[model samples]
Target: MEATPTRHPRRWLILVVLCLSTLVLIIDNMVLTVAVPTIAEDLNASAQDLQWVLESYMLVFAGLLLTAGSLSDKFGRRKMMIIGLSLFGAASLVAMEATSPGMLIAGRALMGVGGALVMPSTLSILITVFDEAERPKAIAAWSAVAMVGLVGGPVLGGALLAQFWWGVVFLINVPIALLAITAAMVLMPESKGPWRKADPVGMVLSVIGMSALVWTINELPKGGLSHHSTQLSLVITVAALIMFGIWETRSKSPMVPLAMFRDKVFTGASFSLVLLTLANGGLMLVLTQYVQFVLGYTPTETGLAFTPLAIATLLFNTLGASLIAKTGTRVMAVLGLLVIASGFVVLANMTTESGWGVLAGAMLLMGAGSGLAMPAAMAAMMGAIPDEHAGVGSALNDTIQQAGAALGVAILGAVLSSTFTRHMPADAPQMARHSIGDALAVSAQTKDSGLLDAARSAFTDAMSATFLVGAASVVGAAVLAAFLMKGKNSGPVPAESAVDPATEAESDAMLTSL
Candidate 1:
C-alpha cells in the first residue's frame, strides 16, 4: 500500500524561512523604485536606461519561472531553494559594489534568475508540507507575509536611504538571504515529486516568447505600437507562443499541461488574478509618483502614507481564508473585486488638493479587496492542480502575475506619458515632457511655478483616466468570477473533481528523468 502523507513537524518554522526568502525578493523589486532618482543621478542614466534597469529583472524573472518550477519538482524543492538563495545573495553583493548602470542592471538580471528559482519552490513546498485540511490557512499566512513585503519595501528602502547610499538597499538583501539559506537548510524538509526530464526546447521557446512580449510592452511607452522594433517583437511573441502551445500539446512529455485551461474554476481564477495584478500594479506605480512629485512628499513620508493600505491588507488576509470556508471562492472573489473597483472609483476623483484622509480611505479599500480576492483566487488555482505538479503549477501562477504586472506598468505608464505630453505646453522642454520627475526637475531649475502647475495638472488628469480604466477592469473581473468560477458555499474543495489521478500519474512518469 502507498504510504499516507504526514505533515512535517517543523512546517511552521520552514514557513518562516520561506517568508523571509520571499520578503527579500519582493523588497528588492520595490526598493529600487524609491531609489530610482538617486540611482539615475548617480549613474548619469536616461529615463530609458532606468526603465531597462527595472524591466530587465522582471522579464528574466518571468521567462525562467516555468523552467525553474519544473526543475524544482524534478529535483528537491529545498535543494533548489538553497541554490536560488545563494545566487540571490551573490547578485546582491554584485549590485552593492556596482558603480555603473550597466553593472547594476546586470546584477538585477542575475537576481531575477535567482528569484524565478526561489518563488515557485516556496508555494510548492507549502502545498507538499501541509495536508489538504490545513492548506488554506497556510496559504493565507503566506499571502499575508507576501503582502507585508510588498507594502513594507518602500518603507524599508526609505529608512536605508535616509542614512546611506542607494547601494545599501541592494546590500541589505545579502545577509537576509544568507540567513534564509541557512535556516532553510536546517529547518525545511527535502521534498520532490517524481523526477522529470528537462524540456530544453520548451524552456527556450517560453523564454523567447515571454521576453519578446514583455519587451514589446516595455517599449510601447517610448515608441508606441507603430515602432518597427515593437512590431517585430509582437510578431515574434505571437509566433513563438503559438509554436510553444502546439509543441506542448504534441510533445510526449509536455512542460505544461495545456488541458488545465479547460477547467472553468482554474481558468477563471487565473484570469482574475492576472487582472487583479494588472490593476494594482498600475495603481501603485502611479500613486507612488503622485505622492512624490505632485504632493511633494519625501520618500519616508510616502512610505508611511501607505500604512493604511498595509494595515487593511493584513487584516483581510488573515480573515479571507476563513471567510472562503463560509462563502466559497466565487463569492469571495467577486466581492473582493467589487470592493477593489469601488476603491478605484474613489481614486479616480483624486486631485492635487485631496486630503491624506481621502487618499488613505481609497487605499484601504483597495488593499482590503486585494487581500480578500487574491488569496481566494490563489487557493482556487492551487486546489485545482494535482499534488505532484505543485511546482510548475505555482510557477504558472507566478508567471501570469509577473506578466500582468509588467503589462500594467507598461500600458498605464504609456497612457500617463502620452496624456501628460499632450497636455504640456508645446514649447515645454523635451526632458520636461518625458516624465513627472523630469518635469519637476525642469520646473525647479527654471524656477517656473506655471510649468510645475501644468505638469501637476497633466499628471492628475492622466492618473484619473488610468484609475477609471482600472476600476472598469476590476468590475469586469468581478463579472467573470461571478459566472465562471464553480464552487458551492462551504468546506474544502472536492478532491475527486479537483485532481485527475490518471493524469497526475502520467505527469509524474513523464517528469522522471530531470
Candidate 2:
C-alpha cells in the first residue's frame, strides 16, 4: 500500500531525520581511515587485518542490499527503518569497545547489515512522502544532503581523530542515531510495498556474483591478472553473474526486474552512474595522501583543504535542481560532464607547489559537476520505473553505486600504485622507500623527505594520468546523456508517470517507455 499524505504536513522534518542518518552513516564508515594507524598500533594488527577491517563492512553491505530491500518490502518501511537504526546504533557501541581487529570488523559487518535496511527505505520513503509536483525538489534536496555526507566524511573523521581516540569515530554515531530514531517515529508515516514475493535464490546469486567480481578486481595489483588464483576468481565471478542473470530472468519474484534494461533511459542512466562513480570514487584517497604525504599538510590542515568541495557541492547541488527545471536534462548532464573533464585536466597537472586556490578551484568545479549529474541521473533511473518497484529500484541504484565505488578504487588505485612503483628511483634507499608497491603499500612509507619527494612527484604524474582517464570517462558519459536523455525540463523519464498513474499502469508504462 502507498503511504497516505500526513495531514500534519511535516515533510521537512522527515527529511531532516533522513539526512542526519545519512551523515552519521557516512561519517562512521570513513572515520577509520584517520584512526587506522592508532588502531593498528594499539591492537597489534597486520596490514592484511587493516584491509579486512575496511572490506568486511563493504562486502556484507553490498552483498545483502537486495535482500534487505526485498525484506523491507515484505514487511513495512517504517518498521524496517526503526529496526535498522537501532541495530546500527548498537553495532556502533560494539565497535567502540572493540579491542581486537576481528571484533571491530565483526562490528562493522553488523553495521553494514543495518545499513542495508536504512539505504533503500530512506529513498523509498521520500518517494512515498512527496507528491509528484514536489518530488523533483524533494529528491534534489535529498541528493544534496547525501552528497554532503560523501564530501564531509573524511573531514569529519579527521576532526574527530584530532580531538579524541579512534573509538570516538564510532561513538559519534550514537547521538545522531538517537535523533533520527526519535524524529522518524514522530514525523514519518509507516508505509509498505505493493508487496511481492522475496527471491532467496536471486539474492544469493547477486551476492556471490558481486563479491567474487570485486574480489577478482581487488586481487589484480597483488597478483597480476595472469595469476592462477586471479584467473580462477574471474572464472568464478563470471559464472556466478551468468547464473544470476539466468535466475533473475526465470524468477517469478526477481529482486531487480530484468526488463528495466530494455528502456534506453534506464540503461543509460544506470551505466553512466556506474562509470562516473568508477572515475570519482578513488579521488579522496589520492588527494588526501597527496596533501599530507607529498605536501606535508597536517590532518587539520587537510580537513580545511576539503572545505571547497564541501561548500561548492552544497551550492551547485542546490542550483542543479533549479537548472534541470529551467534548462533540461540533456544540457545539464552534458555541461556537467564537460565541467568535470575540465576539473580533471586541471587536477592532472597538480604538483607540490600547488596552492589551495588552484586545488580548491578544481575541486569546486568537480563538486559542481557531480552535483549536476547525480540528481539528473537519479531522476532518470527512478522515472523509468513504476511506483511498485521503488524499493527494488532504489536497492539496485545503491548496489551499483557501492559496487562501482569498490571497483573504481581497485582499478584506479592499482594504476596509481603500479605507476609509482615503476617510476620510483632505483637508487632510493630501503628506509626511504620501504613500502613501495602500490597506493596502499607505499602510502605508509611517504615519511622521509627524499622518499616523500619521490612519492609526491610520482603521485603527481600518476594523478595526472588518472584525471585524464576520468576526463575521458566523463566525456563518454556526456555522450550517453546527449543521446539517451529526453530533456532537462523533462524528468529523467517522461513525466506523466511520476505525477499520476495506477500501480499496474506505472509498471506497464515502464515496459512501454523504451
Candidate 3:
C-alpha cells in the first residue's frame, strides 16, 4: 500500500503570513507611484533624482532575487523572511525620515535588498507547507491579496497625501511589517533544502547581468542603440548572462538548475507569463496616464475606477482555482489569454469621447482573464520543480516576468511619446509636443482651449496605438501557449535532493504543528 502524504494543519494560517509579506511589496510600489508628484515637490528633486528614487529599488531588487532565493534554501526560508521583514521595516523608517533625495534613494535600495529576500521565500515556503492538492487554493488567495493591495494603494496614498506629508506613505509599512514579523516568528516553521556548495561566481555574474539588462531596458526608450551608455550596458548584459549560463552548465554544484526549461510545461508557462505581464505592464502604464490626464480624474478617483479590474480578478481567481483541475492548466491559460486580448481590443477602440464605461469594461475583461491565467500558469511552472529547488525556481520566474514588464514599459512609452508628438500641430510649441503633461501645462499657461483639446485628442490616439500593440502581444501569447502545450508529459517532479532523513522528518513535524 502507498503511504498518504502529510498536510500541514496550520497551512492556511501560514499562508496569511505569506500573503501579508507579499502585500507589503505591492502596496509600497503602488503608493510610491501615487506619491511621486508630492515627493518631487517637497524634496525639490530634479527629474533625474526622482527617476533614481523610483528605479533604484527595482534595480537592486531584480538583481539580488536569485541570490537571495538560493541563500534562503541554503539557510532557512522562515528565518530569511523574518530577517527581510525586519530590514524592510527599518528601511521604510529610514526612507520616511530622509530629508534629501539621495537619502531616500539609498533607503529604497536597502528596501530592495529586503524585498528580494522576502519575495522568493514566501512562494517557496508555501509549496513546502501545502500539498499539491491544496497548492492551487493557496496561490489563488495569495494572488487575490495582491489585487487588494493594487486597488487600495492609490486610494490610501491619495488620502494620506491630502492630510499629511508624502513620507507618511512609507510610514504605513512599518506597523504592517512588524505584525507580519511577529506572526511569522511565532507561527512559521523553518524550512531549507539540503546543504550544497556555494557558487559565489554564479551569484556575482547573475547580479551584474540582471542589473545591466534592466539598465539597458530602462534606457531603450530614450535612445536605443544610439546612446553609448545603453550600448555598453547591453553588451555587458549579453556577455555576463551568456557566461553565467555556460558556467552553470559546467559547475559541479550549480546554483540554478537550467534543466527545468527542458520540461515543456515549465517552458510554456514561462513564455505565457512573460507575455501576460508584458502587456499588463503597458496597460497599467498607459491607462493610469489616460485616467488622470485625459479623463481629468484625481488620484483617488483613479484608484476607485480600477475597482472593476480588481473585483473581476479576485472573483475569477477563485473561480479559476476551483475549475483549474477539471479544465487543465493549458486550457485555462489559453482561454484566459484570449479573453485578455479581447479586453485590449476593446481598449484599442477608445476615443476621447468615450467615458469611464469603456475603461471599466476593458478592465473587467482583463481582470477576469488575469484571474484565470496567472494562477494556472504559475501553478504549472512551480509544479515542475522539486521541493529543494522551489526558491530559486520561483525567483527565476520572477526575474523573467520583471524583465518583460520593464521592456513593455519602455516599448509603450516610446510609442506613446513619439505618436503624441507626431500628431501635435506643426505650430505647437516644441515643449508642448513632448508629452501630454507639457502640452496641458502650456495650454494652461497660454489659455489656449485649442491646445488643450488637441492634447487630449492626441493622447487618446496615442493610447489607442499602444493598446493595439498590447493586444497583439496577448493574442500571440495565446497562440504560443496552445502550440507549446501539445503532447507534453507532466509526470510528478522528483523528490528533494538528498536531505537528511532526520532533518526532513523534524521539519515536517514542526510544519504540521500549530
Candidate 4:
C-alpha cells in the first residue's frame, strides 16, 4: 500500500531557520565592504592585497558551488547544512584571530567553502518543503530578508567598529551561525534526490576552470592580455571549461544537467541574473569607497547613507510576487532592468561635489529595480527545473551570479584602476597612482592638496565611466530578456516534472522510520 506523505507541521519555522542561515552569509558579504578601509589601515595592505581579500572568497564560493550541490543532493540537505554552518563558524573564528592580511584572506576562503555548501541546500530544501502554490510567496519572503541583511551589514559593521576592533565583524558571525545550527537541528528534515554515482572528474575540472578564469580576469589590468601569465591562465581556463562541458554531456550521472539550457525561460533568467549581479557588484564596491574616501563620510555615516536603498528594496520586494503573477516574469524582468539602467544613468552624472541627496536617489531606484527583478528571475529559473534536480539547479543559479560578481569586480576594478592612472597628475607619486586609498595616504603624508584634488577628480571620472558601463550592460540584458522571454509568464511547474505527493509521502515515511 502507498503510504500518505506526512506534512511537516513546523515548515514555516524551518523557513525562519533557513532564512537566518542565508542572512548571516549575506551580511558577511556587505559588512566586509564597510570594514575594508579599516582593515587596510590596520593590516597595512596594498591595493592588490585588498583586491585579493575580496576576490578570494568569491572565487572559492563560485568554484565549489556545483560540487557542493551534487554532494548535498547525494547525501542529505539538512546534514550538509549543519556541516556547512559548523565550518562557517569555525572559519569566522579564524578570521577574527588573524594577525595578517594573508591569514584573513585564507580564513575568508574557508568561509567561502562553507557558504558553497550551505547556499544551494537552503533553496533546494525550501523547494521540497513548500508546494508550488506557496513557493513564490516563500521565495519573496526569502529575498526580502536577504535584502534586509544586505542593508543591515553596513550599519552593523559601522556600529561594531565604532566600539570594538575590526575583528568584531567576523566575531558577529559565530553567534548567528550557532543559533542557525541549533534551530536547524531541531526543525529541519533531511532530504535527498535519487541516489546516483558520483562524478569526481567534473568537479575538479569545474573548480580549476573557474579559478583560472577569475585569476586571468584579475590579472588583465596589471599584465594586459598578451602577458605570459595571463595568456597561460586564459588557455587553461578555456581548455578546462571545454573539457568540463564535454564530460558533463557524456556522463551518465552529470553533476549539472546541461539540458536545462534549452529552455528559453531558464536561459533568459540566468543571463539576466548574471548581468544584474555583475553590474551591482562593481558598482557597490566603487560606491563604498566614494562615500568614505571622496565624500568624507565616517563608517557610521556611510551605513546610514544606505538606508534609503534598503527601504526601497523592502517596499518593492513585497509587491514583486503579486506583480509577477499579473504582468508575467518577462515583462517584470525587462522593466526592472530598465529601471536599474535609469539608476545608473542618474549616478553617471555624479561629480565629486554632488550632494548626498543625488546619490540617495540613485540608490533608491537601483534597489527598487533589483527587488522587483531578482526574485522574479530566480522564480523563472527555479520553476523550469524538476524537483529532483533542485539542488543542482539552485547551484547553477548561484554559480552564475557568483561568477558574474567576481568577474564584475575584476573587470570593473581594472577599468577604475586604468582610468584613474590615466587621469592622475603626471607628477603624482607612484604610491598615489595605485588606488584611491594609497592616493589619500600619500596626500596626507605630503600635505599635497593639489594631489588630493586631482585624485578626487580622477576617481569621480572613473566612477562615472563605470556607471555608464553598468548601464549599457543592463540595457543590453533588458533587450535580450525581452526577445528571449517573450510570451513567458511565471507559472506552476508542469505536472509531469513536479514531485508526486504519494512518492513524497513514501519518502517521508522512509526518512521518519530511519
Candidate 5:
C-alpha cells in the first residue's frame, strides 16, 4: 500500500512563521519604493543611482533564485531559511547606515542574496507541511499575509519617513527578520530531497542567463533594440539560456525537471501568471505616481488610498478559497482575470477631474480579481510540481513572475516617459519634457504654473495609454487561461505524475515531517 503523507500537527503555526519571513521581503520592497524621493535628496544621488538602488536588488535576487532553491532542497530548508534571515537582517543594518548611493547599493545587493534564499524555501516548506486537502487554505492565509504587507508597507514607510530618517524604513526589517528566524528555529522541521549530484554548470548558467535576461528587459525600453548595451545584453541572455537548456537535458540529474513543462496545466498557469503580473505591475507603477504627482496627495495619503484595494483582495481570498473546490482552478482564473481587465479599463478612463471615487472603485475591482485569481492559479501550478522538486519548482514560479513584472515595468515606463514627452508643450524646457517629477521641479524654479498644468495634463494622457496596454495584456492572459488550463486543479498533483514508484513511500515518509 502506498504511504499517505501525514499532515503536520503544527502546520498552522509553521504557516505563521512562513508569513513573517515573506512579510519582511514584501514590505521592504514596498517601503523602499515609497522612500525613493527622500533617498535621492538625502544622498545627493543622480537618477541613474536611484534606478540602480532598485534594479540591483532585483537583478541579484532573480539571478540567484534557482540556485538558492536547489540548495534549500539539498541542505535543510529550515537551516537555509535561518541563514538567509540572518544575512538579510545584517544587510538591512548595512543599508540603514549607508552614507552614499554606492554603499546602499552594495547593501541592497547582499539583501538580494538573502531574499533569494528565503523566498523559495517558504513555499516549498509550506507544500511539504500541508497536505493537498489543506493546501488551499494554507496558501490563502500565506497570500493574505502578503496583502497585509502590501497595505502596511506604504503606511509604515510614510509614517517613518515623516518622523525619522529614510533609513528607519530598513530598520523595521531587522526585528521582523530576527523574530521569524527565532520562530523558525524553534518550530520548523527540516526538509530536503534525497542526495543527488550538484549541477554546478546548471547553477552558473541559470544565474547568468536570468541576470542577463532581466538586465536586457530593464534596458530595452530605455535604449531600444539598436543600442549597443541592449544588443550585447540580449545576445548574452539568449546564448546563456539556450546553453542552460541544452545542459539541463544531457545532465544525469538536472537541476530542474524540465519535463514538468509538458503538462498543459502547469504551462498554462505559468503563462497566465506572467501576464497577470505584467498588468498589475504596470497599474501599480503608474497609479502610485499619478496619485502623488497629478492628484497632489501627500505620501501618506497616497498610501491610505491603496487601502481599499488591499481590503477587497483580502476578502476575495477567503471567498475564492472556499469556492475553489467546487469551481476548479480554470473558472477562478478566467473570472478573476476578466474582472482585472475591467478594472484596467475603468482606470484607463480616469481624467484629471475624476476623483478618488473612480480610482478607488477600479482598485477594488483589481484587488477582487487578484484575490480570486492568484491563489487559484498558484494552487494549480504548485499542485502540478512533484514533491521532491518542490523548492526548485517554487523558484521557477517566482522567476516567471519576476521576469514578467520586470518586463511590465520596463515596457510601461518607457511608454509613459515617451508619451509624456510627446504630449508636453513644444515650448517646454528640455529638462521638463521626460518626467512629471522633472517637470514639476522646473515649474517651481521657473514660477510657471502653466508648465505645472501642462505637465499634469500630459501625465494623465500618458497614464491612460499605459493602462490600456495593461488591460490588453490581462485580457490576453484571460484567454490563455481559458484554452490552455484543463481539469479540476484543486487537488494535489498525482503521485505518479513525476516521481519513481519505488521511492514514493520513502519520499512521503520524509516529506510528512517537512
Candidate 6:
C-alpha cells in the first residue's frame, strides 16, 4: 500500500486565507440585500432598481467565471488573484461612494468581475495545496466557511446596517481585502498552467450565453411567458446558448471542454449541484424577506436568527470531511441530501410565531446537510476531472453554484410574488382591480395594519409553499445520489494528467510555500 503523505502544515493557513477572502466576497453579496431598504430610502431607488443592483453583480460575476478561469491559467493564478482582490477593493470604494443607483450597480458589477477572478483561483489553490488523502478535510473546512459566508452575508450586512449606513457594508470589504492582498503577496507564490493563448472567442460566447440565460430568468417574473419582452429575451438567450455550445465544441482552446461532461460523475455532480444551488439561493432570499417583512423581525434579529445555520454549517463541514473517508461518496451525498430535505420540511412548517428552538434545529439540520453535500459534490466533480483542468473544474463548480442561486431566486421569487398577489386580502385585491401592475403598485403603498397582517399571512403561506418546493428539490437530489453517484472514491481520474509536473510543482509551491 502507498504510504499517505503528510498534509502540509500551511494547509490550515491557506484555508484561513481563502475563507477570509470568501467571507469578504459573500458579505459583499448579501450585505446589500439587508441594506437594500436603506439604500432605496437613501438613494430614492425603486424596488426594480434595487433588484437590478443585486442581480447585476451576480449576472456579471456568473457570466465571466469561465473567462476568468482560463485567463488566470494563461496569465498566472497569483497575479490574477492579487489583481482581482485589488479590483474588488477599488470597486468597494466605488460602491461606498456611489451617489446614484446606477453608480452603485456599476460598482457592484466591478465587484463581480473581481469575484470572478478570486473565486476559481482560490479553489485551484486549495486543490494543489492538499493531497487527495487530505483534500476532503481541507475542502470541508473551505466549504464550511463558504457556507457560513453564504448564510451570514445577510446577518453581517444587517449588523453593519444597524450601526452604520449602507455604505459601510461596501467599506467593510476594504479592510478584508487589505488583509487578503497582504497575506497573498507575502505567502502565495506564483503559478501558471499550459495555455499558450487565451480563448477570447470562447470567452465572449460564454458571457453572451450566461448573460442571456440569467437575464431570461430574471425577466420571467415581470413578463411571464406570454409577455412579448420575455419571449424575445428567451428566444435570443436560447439562440445564444446554442451558438455557445457550438463554439465551445469547435474552439481549439475551449473555455469549457465539452468532453468533461462526458464523464457521468462530472455531469451528475454538476447537475446535482445546480439543483441544490437553485433551491438554496431562492429559499434564502425569500426567507429573509419572510423573516423581516412578514414576521417583522428587525435586521439584527434576522441576523441573529440565522446564527444557528452558520454554527451548524461549520460543525457539519468538519464532520462531513471526517466522514467522507469511511462513509464513501454515495453514502455521504445521499445522507446529506436526506438531511437537507428534512430541514426543508421542518422549515415548511415554520410560522411567524415559530419557537426559536425549533427554528434553530431546522436551520442547524439544513446547514449540516448542505455542508455535507457540497464538499462531496465538489470533490466528485473535481476528482472526475484532470488536475490540469482544475481551473476549469473550479470554474464549473462556481458557475453551477452561481447559476443555481440565480435560478433559485428567479423561480422562487416569481412563485412567491404571484402567490402573495393572488392570495392577498380580499379588500386589497379589490383595490388592485385595475391591473396586476396596478395592484402591485397599490400593495406597495398599503399602510393599513390589519391589511398588512393579512398580506403577511399570505406571504408566509407562499414562503411555506416554496419551502416544500425546496424540500422536493432536495429529495430529488437525494434520489439522484442513489442512482447516479455510485461507487466510493473508486472512479477513474479523468484526463487530469493533462497537467504538467513543472506546472503542478509551481502551483503547489504557490499554495504551500508560506
Best by lDDT: 5
Could you tell me which 10 consecutive residues in candidate 5 have the lowest summed lDDT? 505-514
Clashing pairs in 1: 195-511, 195-512, 196-511, 196-512, 196-514, 197-514
- In order of appearance, the predictions have TM-scores of 0.91, 0.89, 0.94, 0.88, 0.92, 0.88
| Tens-digit per-residue lDDT, 1-514, candidate 1 | 6765666899888888888888899888879888999999998988878977888888898888988988888888889989998999999899888888899889989998999899999999988887665666778788878878788888898888889999998898999999999999888888887766677888889999988888887787777877898899999999999999999898877778778888888888888888878888698889989998988888888888888888898888778877765556666778788889999999989998887998999989988997788878888788787777888898999988888887888877877777878888888889998888899999999999988998998899889998888888888887677667764311244343332445334323432321
lDDT of 2 at 153: 69
Best by TM-score: 3
Q: Rank the candidate models, highest lDDT first.
A: 5, 3, 4, 1, 6, 2
Model 6 C-alpha lDDT per residue in residues 1-514, reported as the tens digit of each score: 6765565667678778877887789878767777888899999999878988988887888888888888777777777888889999999999999999999989999999999999988887778776766677778888877777766787778677778888998999999999999888877766667756577787887887787788888888776898887788788778877988998898877777889877776777778888888888777777777676656678778878888888988888888876665545555666787888899899888876776787789888988897788777777777776767777678878888878877888887877777767777666757553223344356678744566556666777777888888888878876665556554332212233323445335433432331
Clash totals for all models, in order? Answer: 6, 5, 0, 1, 0, 2
Candidate 2 regions with alpha-carbon error over 4 angstroms? 1-8, 226-229, 429-452, 487-514
| Candidate 5, 316-367: lDDT as tens digits | 9888876666556666777888888999999989988889999899989998
lDDT (C-alpha) at residue 255 in model 2: 78
The parts of candidate 3 lying over 4 Å away from their true place are 486-514
Question: What is candidate 3's CA lDDT for residue 212?
Answer: 92
Model 2 TM-score?
Answer: 0.89
Which residue pairs of candidate 4 clash?
5-505
Name the weakest run of 10 consecutive residues (lDDT summed) in model 6: 490-499
Candidate 4 segments whose C-alpha is farther than 4 A from its true place:
1-9, 33-53, 99-106, 425-434, 486-489, 492-514
Candidate 5 C-alpha error for residue 470, in Å: 0.8
Cα TM-score of candidate 6: 0.88
lDDT of each: 0.83, 0.75, 0.86, 0.83, 0.88, 0.77
